[model samples]
Target chain A: MTKVIAGASMSLDGFIAGPDETGFEHLFRWLGAGDVEVPTANPGHTLRMSAVDAEYLRDQWDNTGAIVVGRRLFDLTGGWGGAHPIGRPVVVVTHEAPTGWEDTPFTFVTDGVTSAIERAKALAGDRWVGVNGGTMARQCLEAGLLDTIGVDLVPVVFGKGVPLFGELANAPVLLGAPEVVVGSGVTHLRYDVLR
Target chain B: MTKVIAGASMSLDGFIAGPDETGFEHLFRWLGAGDVEVPTANPGHTLRMSAVDAEYLRDQWDNTGAIVVGRRLFDLTGGWGGAHPIGRPVVVVTHEAPTGWEDTPFTFVTDGVTSAIERAKALAGDRWVGVNGGTMARQCLEAGLLDTIGVDLVPVVFGKGVPLFGELANAPVLLGAPEVVVGSGVTHLRYDVLR
Candidate 1:
């Protein structure tokens, strides 16, 4: 069975990004905090992380076959400047599919999150459907389609910013105690969404 | 040297309480998730927690000699109804000291967080000063008096609630990677505040 997981680097105060879309340096500092190097799907864009995090990321990328992202993040990152760093097919949830991209690994879903996730799952096979962006994660969570929450918990306080799952409609969403793995400057927490 | 530490049982999304002041049951479920019984200052109030958390709580209580709180929480818990659960004296930071509560473990400080903590430290001697409530913690952190951030992270998402440090004035407060302790229903993270 393919599981849908929401993944992001969050601050100790639970923000994925600081106000004005800042604080990315602190959030993603762990990506370069150590000596071990892990190559990304993008050419010449390898990530250097702690050995523990490198192994963790390697395992995650190995198991995550496809990714589901919101149009905001897709546009913000300019569609990851081409291929996503995770080397997985991306199923974008947008009202309208963007043009000028033909033979890429991007599938633009002109529907809602549910349809986008279904398409991603079909592409994922027995692997996982990785979800990105707070809006996308919240939609998947509220729809009960999110299986896991993968937070690379950084040690910083962004008083206000983009939350991992922003303004959840069905809140008090119970989750299992996270499987914790402490890295150099980040603690990886994998929480299972309870039914 | 006495350390100033802020402690709270926070939701995964950094909330100390849920919307409408709800979600305490989920936040504190770990206090009764196991069989190890830890007695509080109140004769009849004992907490049953997993062995690891019980030890952690015992050590924290043993090390914490004085607790500082905000007036809102002091009135909310009705002054803990008596002595604090950790059997420590409480120094409440308030605009005005309340009357009718003399010779008790509670001391009302009408000055500020710095004065309150100073008084608490004088009362604490060599032991640590524990700061409670988001407002109190935020003040201490901003004043550069906070030494550690002790977060008992519960596995629940409270979409809207009182944050651990609500609306931080000095954000991007970087912290050291936390010392992680995974309990049955909680994960105790001890993060040192970087000066």
Candidate 2:
């Protein structure tokens, strides 16, 4: 069975993005400092993720067969230059798909987050479906679609920005005991959703 | 030398307190689960903090010679019933000292955070001074008086409450690599403040 997992590098203040939303680079700086190659929207250079951080990042990608992301993230990164960074099938949850990307490799689900996850699960087959972007992950969590949550807590704190878990209409979700891994520049915490 | 160290148990959302400003119990629940005795504002039942959590809590108290807290926290807890919880001297920072408490064990410093810390350092002798409460810790961090910061990151998240670090007049303070200890219910992260 395909399991849905959500992962992101967040600041100590729980902000996945800075005020301008262009600060993921700072929040995920640890990934670049490592020795494993990480695919990014940027084409100029390749970032390295090493040691425990490398293992964690590689596991997240290797286990993931598909991804679900938000429309804003897609738009901000220019639809990953028409190709998802992970080279996996991506189901983007958006109210409206951007024009001219109809033929793109990414699948934009306009119905809702559940619909997007459904498409992702179908694409994932027996593998895991990973969800990114704060809003999409929150929606998956609220809908009880996420099986696991991986948070790479960075040391820095953004005074203000997009919070990871904002006002969710659903009740507080209980999480199982977390797997804690202290990396070079980030602490990786993985928790199973107790549904 | 008496170092000024700030410590607090904060939620994943960086909230030290809940909406009603009385949620430290939930954040610091692991302390009660451990085997060490924690002196709380309430003198009812004794809470034990043992095992790794107990060691951590005991070390914090053993190394602390004095404490610095905000007036609000002091007032809310009725000045720790005229005696500091750790049986050490406490410097309470506020605009004015509360009436009729001038003869209490806790010293109310109206000058400023630096003044309060100075008094705490004198009382601390060669031991470290701890700063508690959100406002006082922030002030110490902003004033470059905090030498270290220990945060026990709780798994729970409060939707809204007092944030650990809100707006600060100074630039972002850089923290050295943290010493991470994963406990039963909380992850203790201790970082050296790079001044």
Candidate 3:
């Protein structure tokens, strides 16, 4: 069975980002000093993350095969900003084609969720597929195409903004009890898809 | 009035660190981007806080004269290990001094929350005091010591863990509507201390 994992960070109040995505430091602080280390530009503030935490994250990425993302995610992700780190095949599900990165050879399809996922599975072969955006991830969930849903629960709460499963009127998506994994107050939860 | 701003990245479920506190990456992914550049041990993943965001954060810090944290926060924070970036006076409210950073110049107080805060304020000399840590933050909240509460709500939820506020008998804390700031999902909320 081809497994699709919806892995993303969320705030304490059930929001993915704030109104304009401000106060993003809360997200980085959740990463602790270890997940990603950036020297404070202020030079007056110090931060650090546990090394043991970093190794754990690298392992999670190893379980994936291909990645599927939406236009919003594709745009915000800085287009790998001239570099592709994951190296896995990427399938972007979008209504419009992105400029510049067209040379990178990523598959662009407007065939909606199912078709893009099918192509991603084909490219992924025997590996797990990573569902990369909240809305697109919800679409896959609505279609009952997801194999696994991974939610990393962060500790802070944004009163409002985009939600993980933004306003879908589709059929109910049953989820299993999430198995919890803790790192830097970011809880990694996994729910297996049945039916 | 010295105003200290305390902030951190959090998950949707209110978890500071997931199960092992080492496996989750979504918070790191959402944060530490170009806006909040987080430099990773991996040269490839190093990031820097965007000037806009950095300036915003710095502006928040500028209002404070001292910082107050609890025992757990101090311990979990790796004692600002190897890099105590903030030169401002730091007051750690703990039952006992934590090991390792004993040599660090920060004041380690083995006293109650109120006393520690007062001492910090005295040292601050007209500067505002910033308090971090769930227990101490709550303590200040309960004692009606805090003038304002700033919440940088990250979007995610953990079913359980150290709560933002522990059990306080029927007393309620009132928060004002939050203001949208930066990024895709971060929001800043304000709360007036209404005992």
lDDT per residue (tens digit) for residues B51-152 in model 2: 788677767789999999998888888877777767788889999877787666688889999999999999999999999987888888888898888899
Query: Can you list each candidate's DockQ?
Result: 0.87, 0.43, 0.04
Assess each prediction's global lDDT (C-alpha) against the native.
0.92, 0.80, 0.60
Q: Of the candidates numbered 1 and 3, which has the greater lDDT value?
A: 1
At residue A145, give the lDDT of candidate 1: 93
The 10-residue segment of model 3 chain A with minimum total lDDT is: A38-47
TM-score preference between candidates 2 and 3, better one? 2
DockQ-derived CAPRI band for the predicted complex in model 1: high
Question: Whose DockQ is higher: candidate 2's or candidate 3's?
Answer: 2
* Alpha-carbon RMSD, each predicted model: 0.8, 2.4, 17.5
Predicted model 1 interface RMSD: 0.9
Q: Estimate each model's TM-score.
A: 0.99, 0.91, 0.48
Q: What is the CA-based DockQ of model 3?
A: 0.04
The candidate maximizing TM-score is 1
TM-score comparison, 1 vs 3, better candidate: 1
Worst 10 residues of 2 chain A by lDDT: A167-176
DockQ-best of 1 and 3: 1
B104-145 per-residue lDDT for model 1 (tens digits)? 999999978899999999999999999999889999998899
lDDT of 3: 0.60
> What would the per-residue lDDT of candidate 3 be over residues B1-195, giving only the tens digit for each residue?
564344445444344443445313543333454556544323454445656555555665566677888877677766665333444667888787757666554778897888888888887777778887667766886776777665553444333344455444323343332333544333344444533
Candidate 2, A22: how far from true, in Å?
Answer: 5.1
DockQ-better candidate, 1 vs 2 = 1
- Listed per model in order, the count of residue pairs whose N, CA or C atoms clash below 3 Å is 0, 10, 62
